[model samples]
Each structure stands twice: as structure tokens, then as C-alpha cells.
Target: MDVKIDSEGAFGSAIVTLEAGEKFVSEAGAMHRASPNMDINVESRRKKMKVYGVHLSLSESNVCR
Candidate 1:
């Protein structure tokens, strides 16, 4: 999960570049601290069929919310 973000800041002066995996881990940690119920599951996909269901749930949440 390599992450690269390109965006102008409020002042539009500084450029920020962050690794996606690093950001997700950092955010997941903070979110976990604030709300103890959301379990951030980081799993390497072993099979397509096995992960399809999990991916569907995550995708649905992304759109429905």
C-alpha cells in the first residue's frame, strides 16, 4: 500500500507527501484509541474468493456512509 498524496494546503505553500500504508497505520491507531470498537484489520489476501466478501463490506461502507 504505497501512498502518495498531492494537494495544495490552505496557504498553498508547502507540499506534503506521505506513504499510504504509513498514513493508514497512523490513522488506524488514532481511530482505535478514540473508539475501541473499530478493529482495523490488515490482512494480506491469500485467495480472491475469500477476500471478495470482506471487500464488498468495505466497499459498501465507503459508498453508503
Candidate 2:
């Protein structure tokens, strides 16, 4: 997998290239585009984990910017 980030801050858009059978997870709506052969799937986070009900924990800091 290859990652390229474009911007001058801690948060920016990224382009990723994955080889065959590779996998990646992004924020729920982070994906804006993908290659034609890319396989995209949306699955429940809780179901995938099978241990939690529901939870959302997010933290942001400007220290890296």
C-alpha cells in the first residue's frame, strides 16, 4: 500500500494505492474516489467487532499542525 497526503496541515486529503488483496479502513465518509477495480464495502462497526453495542470516540489536536 502507498499513501500520499496533499496539504500543509495535520488533516488533509489522501490518495492511497493498494496492491491486490490489500485492505484499508477510513472514516465512514472519507472516501471520495477509488480505482475502477477497487472493491468497496460498508459494514457495521459493531457487527464487525462483535463485542460492543455502539461507541464513538474522537479527539483532535492542533499540536501536529
Q: In model 1, where do residues sit more than 4 Å from their true spots?
A: 11-23, 27-65
Q: For candidate 2, list the clashing residue pairs, or say none.
A: none
Looking at model 2, which ten-residue stretch has the lowest summed lDDT? 54-63
Q: What is the TM-score of each candidate against the true structure?
A: 0.17, 0.60
In model 1, residue pairs whose N, Cα or C atoms come closer than 3 Å (at least 3 residues apart or on different chains), thus clashing, are 3-20
lDDT of 2 by residue, 1-65 (tens): 68888655655688776655556777666666765555566665655555322222122321122
Give the CA lDDT, 0 to 100, for residue 56 in model 1: 10
Whole-model Cα lDDT per candidate? 0.30, 0.55
User: How accurate locally is residue 60 in candidate 2, as Cα lDDT from 0 to 100?
Assistant: 32
Which candidate has the highest TM-score of all?
2
Which digits, one per residue and each the tens of the lDDT, describe model 1 over residues 10-33?
A: 523222222222223332112212
